[model samples]
Every structure is written in structure tokens, then in C-alpha cells.
Target: MITNFLHDNYKNITRVSILDAKKVFYPMKYVLEKRDILIDDDSALIILPFPEDIKYPSNTKMTDAGMLWDYKVEISINNQSALTENQLMRFLNKKVIVVFHHNDGKIIFGCNEMPLQYGYSEDNSVNPAAHCGYSVECRGNSYYSKVST
Candidate 1:
């Protein structure tokens, strides 16, 4: 099971921190491999692989590879320039879901709700991963957007 593997392998190693609310961290190791899948203009369906050295809280258990609980994300984008000084700030108000996928399937991390955004910044630096050329897909949505760090 995922929990068992995480506990036995990454229980004591691997750490992540979000420097900015607009950005999501994608480990450097997977950056190159992730580039190809994310660069497509089409809404790409790709699995997010987690490093074996990362572990979830013991209390949080996964019945399958695609199930995760207690992780929540919110993303907001501004369609109008006058509403917010920074376009990325719009994402602050939107609900977001960080999905993790593996060989099995996709799992929603945090909350399973759709997020709201008023506008989106043309600036790619808003999302670090996207700055590196990775595209992000909203779960279950046909839209494909770029994430700029």
C-alpha cells in the first residue's frame, strides 16, 4: 500500500515548502521528465509521480494510489486588470486542488472542490513550475493553463 511504502521509505526524509501561494513545488528531480508531458497545448492528462522519499502523515492512509485527504489548494485568476494589482493575486481567492497521479490513477490532494479566480496574470513567473515550461490542467476541466513561478 502507499502508506506502508511511504512510512517504510520516506518516513524520515523529504520535505517541501511553498514559498508563494501562487506557486506549487515540483521536485527538481522530476522537472525534466515532467516538461514533455506538460508542454502540450492540448489539455494533457499526466500522472504526477511522488518521490519515494516522501511520506504522508501516518494518520492519513491511502486505500489506493489515487486517494489523498487533508490537502487543500485554492487558485484564483483575474480576468480584469482593474480588480487586482497583480493578476496572480486573483488566484488567491479561487479554490484549487493539487492532484497526484501515479501508475494506478489520479488522486486529489487537499480538498475536492473547484477553485475560483477573477483574473490570470500574463506573467509566467507567477508559477515557478510553469516558468520552467510545465503546463497545469485543472482537474476534470478541459482547460489547460500555464503556471508561472
Candidate 2:
């Protein structure tokens, strides 16, 4: 099977700073050869969404590979942070991903020949507690007929 096995080639891995509201991060690493995601290896991007954290997938569009689904994840430190205003503002424009919680089984976006693209946001804001955060939306397009995990 073909895979993107180039070591340390992901550019998105360089945008981590503080924690979100739930102490998790986004846009974890995707190892092609392993067919698995590296959530907590060298980064703090383990976004295990809670049952209520799973939001709706919006902005449907057709892709050459398959259907592209956009997922919005609200990440805010709010009252759970210690970063300065400028430091907290760095979370914007960073890549993110779509997350979900499944007890029956685990779900993986995209497929063998194709992987999801990192998502970004248009707007970000700070809370009353002087924390910065925004809604990051990522897209996943499957190559096959279904979104196989």
C-alpha cells in the first residue's frame, strides 16, 4: 500500500501553545503507514470529544475524492488558562480537526488513498476571563463510498 511516510513533514505540528477549555488540543498527527493518529506523542493535541462536544457537520461540498464534510469544534480556554492576551491570540488561524465520541466503536475520517485537510477559522475572540479561542472547522473527504474508520 502507498503512504506518506516522510518523517516530520507535517507543518501543522508547529502551532500548539496552551490548552483548550477541556485541556485538549486539535489537528493531531496522522500516520499513514500506521493507519492511526498520533494524538499525544510529542504534542498535546488529543481531542477526545465528549458526547455533548460533538457538533454538526456543516458546509457540505463535493470533492474530487469524495464528499467533503466540515466539522466545527468550539475551543476556548476562557476561565481555564494563564496565557497573556497576546499569547492566547495565537490559537487563531491554526489548523484543527473534526472530533466525535462513540462508545460502540471508533470513527476515522477519510480513507486509504485520501486524508482530511486541516481546518481554520475566520474569527476568534477572548472571554471575560482573558482567554482566547475560536471555532475551528476541519474537512474530511473519503475516497470510498463510505467514511470508514
lDDT of each: 0.28, 0.34
Which residue pairs of candidate 2 clash? none
Question: Candidate 1 regions off by >4 Å?
Answer: 1-69, 72-90, 110-149
Which tens-of-lDDT digit does each residue in 35-85 have in candidate 1?
211222122122222354223332333443322333222222222344333
The C-alpha TM-scores of every prediction are 0.24, 0.38
For candidate 1, which ten residues in a row score worst on lDDT? 136-145
Score residue 109 of candidate 1 by CA lDDT: 31
lDDT tens per residue, model 2, 95-134: 3322232332223444323334444333344555443443
User: After superposition, which runs of candidate 2 have C-alpha atoms over 4 Å from their true positions?
Assistant: 1-35, 47-50, 75-78, 83-92, 98-101, 108-149
| Model 2 lowest lDDT segment of ten | 9-18
Clashes (backbone N, CA, C under 3 Å), per candidate, total 24, 0
**Residue 143 of model 1, lDDT score:** 15
